[model samples]
Target: MTSVTPGVPERQAARPASMPVRCPSQVCDLDVLPDGVVVTDATGVVTAVNSRALAILGADRDAVLGADARVALPLQDLEGRSWWTCADPYGGLATRTRISETLLALPGDREVFLTATLGRERPRGPVVQVVVVLRAAAARRRAEQKTSALISTVAHELRSPLTSVKGFTSTLLRRWDRFSDDQKRLMLETIESDTDRITRLVAELLDVSRIDSGRLELRRQPVDLPRIVERHVEGLVASGHAADRFVLQVQEPLPEVWADPDRVEQVVANLMENALRHGAGVVTVAIAGSPGQDFLLVRVSDEGEGIPEESYPMVFTRFWHSTRRGGTGLGLYVVRGLVQAHGGTISVGRAPCGGAEFCFTLPAGAPEHVA
Candidate 1:
């Protein structure tokens, strides 16, 4: 996690400890607040500085009060330019102007940004005071930047190879006279493989985008749960996923539930893919109803290294991969989102199969949907 800079105070000549003080209003009690509070009169004069502010800035409160705010505490914009003369809500030129709606990068590795706001009214009141509020800016820009970069990189990297494969396949099919039957078969196989790779990449990208945008619309209809699980098993085994290496034990005549048929297949497929790649021994995919349950339960379990107990909560988070190989980190995230979109929940934990088990719920009745 990147650290955010805290607000800064100004460097000025120190005042003697015995400076006379006057309280402007009850709000002046803000100096006692835990946060490093600083107040400036409408004239830009430091009306009061809290003890916390003094400690944070390494200055005496008596020395800071009655001083020019810009002199006691300096501020800068993102470009490293001084913002002393920025916009002010009050109409006073000499008053130590209060800074509002601004971020002050302090001298430490703090992740929380300090935001100041006007606490005192001007003109009708003292026209010379302002209040500041400090809070952590939970903004996440790095992940957004990384995702954008990944989309661009993946598009460019895959386009050339896919184009070449498609071109050769088209040429061979069009000019069948130039190649023997064996040559044609080989080229076709290459074409099929390339097409499959492109398809997988496209599908993954689509799912990730839909999940990020929160626009993954589901078409829920009553469907047999067992049929969906069985279909995925048959397809995976026929597709050479070591059919005999793992056991897919599922309950028969599973409860019929409402869910998107196609999206459900994608969810099950992604889970099985995870199990096959990360798990050892038998990878079990099971579907059973919760005891006296109003929802249908589905679980995909693997006998691989089970996730550390500490990492269980993070498994469903976007781009959180346990291992460094053959994982997009988006599969479980999208899966959870899709399940929740259908008014359900998901959990990951130790499975009886000995690896990791992902269990999800599908509401037996219609539930509230989110956009």
Candidate 2:
């Protein structure tokens, strides 16, 4: 542990026996703070240091407490000037000034870019303490990067559907008299399909916002799992997916599930669509009652190349797509959110057919009474 400089007041000596110290807020407890905190006297001699500060500095609490703030922190401005000299701490300037473009060099050869704010605890007191708060610059940069990527992705996804709709509509309007009935019908269908695609993309974006704000809601009711699965398969076929490509298997006398019917359908549809787009061979949807359990287990499996074990944890994260052209990168994230809202657990694994398998369990409805 780094040792604090000598001549500083000990923890007991800092406070008078007559006066008790009280924390004004939970943040006053330095241990719970996410950012590093260091307190120094007006002359820049360290008086107190938080655990986070010690960890960030890679020094011991005792070593930092009495040390000069400049030696312990050694911050440098963007122009390579010492932050302590430039800031002029001992001058009559207020301690509340924000320090920007500062770099802190740790003892272990690691450096952290940071922004700091300095404030005084007692402005007119004889022994004033300057409080410094440190925030990591790298974290902010990462957040900015993610925001830029999301904007780019949204623009790209929206442009494709909009282009298709515009091109089809323009062609039909210009060549309406020359087109036969079949050609007009085909163009109209294409436009409608493109419109549906745009709607789905917008809906997924809204769901993501709702999930982030903790406002995702579910209306739970008794739902027939097998029926929902069968209906989704049929809908896929109607949307041009080959009917023979899907296989549905339901265990005999399976109990109805306690879930939101619409959300359950959404989950099944998303998983089926993912399988159709990414997997090879027949896609299988299976539902079975868990023996001696109150949940019904459902699995959507495909015979395409299986997902790597390392990638399983990230599959359900928002904006993460396995392929460059995958839809919106929000399908699995929304599916997981809906399943969890219904008191269910979902997981991904290798199927028996050597491909990706998504398994989820939903609460079973009340059991029927025997006559």
Candidate 3:
């Protein structure tokens, strides 16, 4: 799902087989860090530099450790202004603490962002040392670009539905007596559907923010997942799908799950919608519980052209839809988040009918269920 927000350690440098891998903290283990670190004295003289910092700054360790901080690490903002000259950690206000993370350019086109933690004896006191934490800015910049694209796309998507709703309502209001009952009903129904779309888009934005911020929470309750699926199937039929196109297979005596009802329905709705919209033929939903009733598994498949194996990984990522339209493209991402929040996993594969199949699971609930 686009709105749903969501790693490994760096490999150590190869060492001689006989050499020990121990990092002695007493001698300062800063060299083992993946992030660049540079520590300077109050006078802005470099006191210590890590191997990562040397690599990032492209400066020799011997030349940098005892050299002037400004001379050792020449950094400038986009406008070519010196970073140290602007920061002035020692000359700035006594109350000033750490320098916030900033993007700066080095010689050539290399870019790095760093933040300095100011060590102080007391508030508004003289600075002791500036501990600058540094990292390559390429990944962060890429993330910013993606965020901007998603925001632009979401805004564009929201506009279309809102414009339709406004147009329909305004027309109906201006010519109320000119329309027949059936026509008016149709217009109102269209508006209602558009309104639902707008609501879902807004909810997706909020869910994405929450998921990204690690604040997305589940209102746990005993959920009849199969019933939820059945209700969604009914909704699909009501929305104009043929009844026979959908087949619901529930392994009776299935266990209930502890999940949020809205989230549970959202997962089902997204999958069923994808099956109908992207895949061809009949849609089949199969539900069963794992051994020991620890978790419940739901598999949704279609009789259409299944997703290619290569695109399987991209299916659950934000805005991954290459051809599909009329969606924020965040459904599967949000579904993945919801499923994962319940300590479960979701996967994609070819179905028995040669169509795409999505399978997800949820943890079992307690006997004293809410609903």
Candidate 4:
């Protein structure tokens, strides 16, 4: 057999301490550790404990010491069962086998959690003592409840706009012949614009889920950078902005970029939409070619009221809007993600046109031949 270490004692020789340290008179004297600690004897009688334990149990040291420890700190199993079958599920004092356990409050009216372990001095002896640590469980539960409420509120708010767009589109499509050519075109335009708005909102919702799940995917393809820019701007114009309201400045003989075509379109569209919403008169879409750099630099500028210098960096963050306009505030968030997927960068700043400017970069290369 191996020899025992100097500090180690055999189970047969270990005995419980009958005496406990009397807590000081100072009510402010609490233990350094957040958890309240309690030391008990082998027979489960209370011995020594910190002031935190005293406050946790709402009892004086004289009233607790030498009493059955289980009367102050009880033990519970995983299923929350008590030592006796008739005990209240939460009322009985019980130490949990696991590190995290929720228990009922004493007279203090605050929920308490007890974490305990069996401490032994000898291998063969009964657990000579059980040390129980206490913490309040109410704070964590409150935080979780608040987060659940926020999610429910956001979901309910989003459903209204989506329902409006869906109902109008379905109604128009079902009775196409009942409308005149001009009416038909107007209804079609409304349906198309509303559908775009709905799509953007749904995409934003999915982007949030993708970010949480780590499943954002970008499809890289050979795309004509300038052509995509012009197309997106034109489509956005059809949505609201007139053709003459925005100007395009793309260098001739533009290079094809290695990018996700649809995502790239989303980036350009979001920037242009932001410009139209925040800017005053003219919005310029500029594409400059960087020959040796293997990237195409693009800038979307508007002549509206510029953003404050301090708010520049926050524009791309999720649900950030500096203005009072009715927007879901996810446009720039989606833009940044799409730009990053192409291994590109995007930034916002004051535009020379007295508005806000959004700039981004993408790879510049000739279209690759497909099989």
Least well predicted 10-residue stretch by lDDT in candidate 4 = 83-92
Top model by TM-score, which number? Answer: 3
Candidate 3, backbone clash total: 8
lDDT of 4 by residue, 1-371 (tens): 84432211222333556323345532234466677777665555566677778777778888777666656654443455443133322222343222345464544345677765665444443355556677766776876775575476457656776676777677777987787888867766776766676676777778766754668887777887678877876787776767898788978656667777888887887788777777778888898877665788999998888888898878887567867555766667777877876778999888886788888998676435421
CA shift of 106, model 1, Å: 3.4
Better of 2 and 4 by TM-score: 2
Superposed on all Cα atoms, model 3 deviates from the true structure by an RMSD in Å of 10.3
Error of 3 at 59 (Å): 5.2
- Compose the digit string of candidate 1's lDDT tens values, residues 280-344: 77777777776665778888888788888999988887657777454456678788888887778
What is the C-alpha lDDT profile of model 2 across 1-371, one tens digit per residue? 64533323223334433232334453247778888888776456676667877877778887887678878887666556665667654343443455564565444545566654444455532334456667665687787887787788889999998999999899988889999999899989989989998999889888877877889977767788888988888888897888899999988767666667898899998998888888889999999988855788999999999788898999998687775357778889888888887778999999999989999989777424311
lDDT, residue 359, model 2: 99
Cα error, residue 172 of model 1, in Å, equals 5.4
On a 0 to 100 scale, what is the lDDT of residue 54 in model 3?
Answer: 92
On TM-score, the stronger of 1 and 4 is 1
- Model 4 earns a TM-score of 0.57
Q: Against the hidden true structure, what lDDT does model 3 obtain? A: 0.81
What lDDT would each prediction earn against the true structure? 0.67, 0.76, 0.81, 0.67
Could you estimate the TM-score for every candidate? 0.65, 0.79, 0.81, 0.57
